[model samples]
Target: MSDALVTHQDIALRLAIPLEKAHEPRVNTLIQDSEELIQDAFAEVGRDYRLEVANLLQRRAIIRVIREMVATAVIVGPYSGARSVNSSSGPNSDGLTWDKVPEVSFAGVKLTDAHRRALGLVVGNDFAPSWNFPPATRWPLRGGDN
Candidate 1:
């Protein structure tokens, strides 16, 4: 019944968490936070995305994106800011050495360009060929009747 595009059930499925686990208070907060982030992102772009989700297909697409966002946040957890673990090893003389740490981590979920496209928030440019025409008629310039 919440206004969030996705439900706890959806997040649970994505995260492979139990239904009861997904119902945890923190899970609900994560859902709300993800929804707000999406709304704010659209608002920043001067788009009323809520209005655009009127279509059933469009709504589903947005919901899918929101659910994924929440699930990602849950997987990352609040304490840990790691978006991905490149590689890990257990007890070695070499010890644990990170080849590279990402500049940004999934502390919070943000809409990606792919998500925007899937949500129909981004409009593709028309690549059809176009020509500029003179104000005057081309026939007249071609020596036709003025």
Candidate 2:
């Protein structure tokens, strides 16, 4: 009930698990951790978490990789084009723009938010942003409900 964000340590304790449970060779942990992180981020943004969780849970399988690694924020941005390495664009620039996009005011919002924002800017454009966490590290995002 404190007006503060929760940490992964708190969540781990609650599960009677370790902060590294996210890397315990199980897929479900990734999904649950991602879900919890998304929920917590939304809560930070003053969103109705019950509704958001319900919406994301409907497609849980898609986000199942999050437990073992950091879920991306590219999904939260707008798409630009074929999005491949080409002569026209490379290394993070597809020449995208944010027009009518919902502006987010919180930090650590997930990649899904970027996707939604990108869509708001352009209905059919594909946008992706790299959060750039070392893929091999698999740091389970910490803090929520903890």
Candidate 3:
């Protein structure tokens, strides 16, 4: 019942998923499940900038979570052939193979360095201020001008 940080429309647009699928209950559940992680990331931005950080970073985080959920479901779902297999030999070879379920990688679901930078949760190298230097009067000065 609570508001989602990213909408089905947003996910459809960003992830190129069908609108119906993006709006599915399972997708919404995944988004809701990721709320705690998103909130924790937002908390790292500090109180003063929390609003702004959430405004900018929540969509990307939600998209990542949704993608992860879908991937995991697909990898372990019945359609993935994890418990069954088809063989070209004959009916004798058509029995269940009982293949190991693939290990789904969730790296993409976590917040990245770039996301942290955008949210101001992590700072990059600082550049020294040039305010003390006088403005150059000429455009094509030689290297010795300094």
Candidate 4:
């Protein structure tokens, strides 16, 4: 089993975000979000083996999820702009309107093929099953042994 795994500091370093003690909560949340998906994708892999998987590849996967989450947060967060003046009070026609604002949605993240392979998860094209039985020698082994 691998001894080391991805950490919040590793993610911050990967994304070039300034690491602060105060950011730990948010970072931990992000890691938890990514880990849930990771766990689902790699359900067949034992927890111990998962820790031993390629650290770089796992970190990359986590980084992708983190980036998506950060983008969604920014989009849904408050908008920073100048104070708006009442359009009916002045002759000026310049103003911001929400009539054409597009709907914002945060689609949950999915594990990529690379990420799955790195974490020892089965790929869609690969059909090998994890069976414990020995291979059969012959097809017909019923009544007589001749």
lDDT of 3: 0.49
Candidate 1, residues 21-102, lDDT tens digits: the string is 6356766776777677667767877878767567789778878887776676666444344334444466533333333222
Per-residue CA lDDT of model 4 for 29-122, tens digit only, reads: 6556656767665565555425534566666655565455443333332332323434665676666534322222233233456556655667
Please report, as a residue range, the 10-residue window in candidate 2 with the lowest summed lDDT. 67-76
Stretches > 4 Å off in candidate 2: 1-25, 54-146
lDDT of 2 by residue, 1-146 (tens): 74223334433444433435544333234334455765555566566656543564423422332322232212222232223332354565444433332322123223354543322222234454546666686568678833
Q: Deviation in angstroms for 55 in model 1? A: 2.2
Candidate 3 per-residue C-alpha lDDT over 1-146 given as tens digits, one digit per residue, 9 for 90 to 100: 53555444544455543446534665455455445555676665554334543565655544555455444443343344346657676546554665544432222133434545544455444354646877878778689876
Stretches of model 1 off by over 4 angstroms after superposition: 1-3, 19-23, 78-106, 123-146
Model 2 earns a TM-score of 0.26
Judged by whole-model lDDT over C-alpha atoms, candidate 4 comes out at: 0.52
lDDT of 3 at 138: 75
List per-prediction Cα lDDT, in the order shown: 0.63, 0.38, 0.49, 0.52
CA displacement after TM-score superposition, residue 143 of candidate 4 (Å): 42
Model 3 TM: 0.39
Q: Name the candidate, 1 or 3, with the larger lDDT value.
A: 1
